[model samples]
Target: MFCQLNKTKKRWRSMFTVVLTCPKEQEKCKLPPEVCWHIGASISNGSWLSQFLSVFLTDLKIDQIVTFLPLPPRALPLQELVDELYNFRDCYFETHGVEEAGRKQSDVAKEIEKTLKKLEEKEDHFKHKAEFLLQKGRCLNVAPDFSAVAEECLSRAVKLEPGLVDGWNTLGEQYWKKGDLIGAKNCFTGALQQSKNKVSLRNLSMVLRQLPAADSAAHAKQVMESVDMARQAVQLDVTDGTSWYILGNANVSLFFSCGQNPQLSQQALSAYAQSEKVDRAASCYPELHFNRSTLFQYEEMFSSALGGYSRAAELDPGWEEPLEREKQLLEYLRKVTELLQNKGKVKARRLRTMLSNLSTSALGPCSSPEFRSPTGRVGSLEPRTLSSLTQGHNAGVAALGKVVFSLASEGRMAFTFGMVDSEETCIVVMVYNTADSWGVLIGDSVVIPEPQVKRNSITHKDESFDFRSIRVDSPLLLIVNGKKQNVQSQLAASVSYKPLSE
Candidate 1:
């Protein structure tokens, strides 16, 4: 049945998704129905194994992924997944009854290359050929890089048979690894068409959840539909907790990426709680605990959220989300204390309540920086005025001056951040460069995986534009979303630029 489908795929190639081949041992298949494996896929191209496999660094996660992809400058710690692949290698030798000591952990290329060499020889069975390709790709892809050869192998396997759900899913996983959410979505959709696989559904939902918001009514409708599809996946298969967990996460996306939907909060919490209360095996998923903790943090259930985040960190000791969130929360907590000291009991309490409720959380759209001057709290700059911006403020960091720069293919935006109570705020002068039509975007977080600690600058992008600027936690972002004129690369040089402050 699937063989005919393969022939059909060759005739009409409209979609980007791969068609999977039949399994080599199909009499009674033991392998997973969907073979989507994402060692580390971001939005660019899901074959992101190089980021996680080569030197065993793995700081990237689904949250940081965007339609535009950038290589991490530093190595992320990925020892756990690396160890599993090593075990797979050893088990392969053991099952074949070979007695040579296992391959050195550091030399990942030798074994994967050996398999790649074997794949060079023609095989009669397309199913087996695809399996061999997946295996080699698996071994070869522990990253600091990406592999086109592996992508081709998997692509060929799926072309040989569209029903090979595993092949399609794996191919999609490669795209997800590279942060190519659109590509990942297509692959998972293809897998779902062949068979109702929960993993593919969950994965598709995840990719959809991370997409940037669409302003047009049509695009907004699509986002809601994507969230609903994720819910459907959970409804279709109630046995596992993964889909439930994904469903919770998808709702969180709706809250963040999409505009407000009053019930989203309760729905997200319900889904997370459901993941925890599900069968013991379902409760075992790490994402469940981590996501639950994140939602709790959002809800201002600080103590409970801390415990959940701690558990998530424990579950995946190498993972950084829980740890990073912990830091952000601590910073937020410290600020709360400062508010109490500076504003006295009444004012501090209101700010505390605001933090707890988070009426406008971290996912707001790009708008002009609420320069203290905008609200009449402080006055705008004139030719010779130098007001005491941070002289008396000891509780928090002050938003100093902002700058905007434009590049031909990209734009740069930065906000100078400094201690609200420290002398640095009073000493440094902030500068701003006006663009034709760009605004400052506040409340977004960007975490680069390569160099976990990027002290100098940060970069992020969406479907339309690219952004690069300083490393402050929530620095003002430069935007170039809809300018019709040709952008000049030297626009930034003409305008003054500076790094984001700590």
Candidate 2:
């Protein structure tokens, strides 16, 4: 116990006692790392004892890492160690090139045979055996895994070197791809326990996301927890694009499970866009676009969804998910177009953005130049809002009140809510006419780049939390306040949209 007994200070209200263990009888209660290092090196006592010394020093170094302690001499740097591990993983992955599942099963088998034969000539090394199994597992003709053999080899490799972080992570992934969620979960947990790292944490969070849910609410809770882990991983290492993608994926899951949370949906979309910006593989990443496209499809943004799905299909022709979604969305697109073309019953349909001075629809006071209109932010629906969405305006209004992104309940439209401080790091959804980035999408479609709403030449009022909505009905005439500007999205006969006005 550490005490201030000799001091004139008050009797110790609290004391912290630290105890450390030693392998052998030590005369001193505490030993410096240098002394430990020298003693360890001397006792191991052979030219080949460098290995044991390295092991000891490495453990000591790792233990001190969170404390931000400097490394003792003759110990490996953590980053250098991580680099070496990654180099080994990359070398193995690159050596085989991309494995084509159905076509190259025999070739992969042959490659395994060659590797096994070469290994027979040497003293069977753990890394060599592990590498053989890794190649075999990765090359297996089944989807994304080698079945039992790959798992067996990978499991053995980690057994051979329990400290090998990469092997544990890879094995965990293999298990996950094979649908052994519990097995995958355990492996990732083991990896994190052994080595707390961004890759392992990110993987663990994804595995958590995939775990089977007991019920709807249970799944939502799980997704929220998983999202927290994913966000933590991203914060730990922003450079890792995979972490960002995982974060987006978790948010998307939460968006669905938690009664279709619009805020979560927005987070999912933003995270995805950020992932695309940073991830080089996004160009040909089928899963990335497919997931993103799926979001668009749910939003009834058909044109955007179609583009995403098409690009995903082009990237991986074998993937079925994109093809299926594309087919469904195409039908939706046709229906939307036909509905727009034959709208005899409806009064009118358009995203009615009326200025105060407009004759037909005047949302704000013409006298006051400081009022900003409420803007709609798009959100994807799962089972909710789609029925009314597919139907016409009244159905839309009825469904709009129940929409996942419905700001009407909050007394305004979507995109109307933002931080009071505009410059702060926060979500911003502005008017289509004034926002630099905005687009229009009919049901299940966004036509390439929707025509830009001509920028408002007038300045806007200062931001406020005070929100109010007014009822205005007008045919979109593209004329306001005796001035005209070009709007990219037009109200044609076929376009399907209900004005967000009561």
Task: Give the candidate number with the greatest TM-score.
Answer: 2
- Pick the lDDT winner: 2
Clash count (model 1, backbone only):
45
Root-mean-square deviation (CA) per prediction:
22.6, 19.0
Tens digit per residue, CA lDDT, model 1, 1-502: 1111112345544332221223343333332333212211332243333322222212222232122112343222223333455455433433332122222333345655544444444334433655555555554554324557656766887876778887787777777666676887898899989998776877766665455555545545655776777778788877656677667777765664443343886898887777657744345444566666655544445566656766655544555766666555554444433332343223434434433432212212212244232123432222111133223221212232211111211222222211111111111111123343433322212211111111111111211111111222111222222111133311221211011000
Model 2 agreement with the true structure over 1-502: per-residue lDDT tens digits: 1111122227524432222334332443354645445544443445433453345446555353211112344433223433433343323323333343223335444554544444343325433565544444433322344367667767777877787677777787777767787887788788888977877777777777667789756866777888988898899888767778878877776765554556877898888777767755443456667777666645535466777877766655566666776666554333323332333112223212111112212111211234222233232211122122222222102111100111111111112211101111111112211222322212111010011111111111221121111111111211222222245422211101011000
- Worst 10-residue lDDT window, candidate 1: 493-502
**Model 2: runs farther than 4 Å from truth?**
1-143, 343-502
C-alpha TM-score for every candidate: 0.43, 0.47
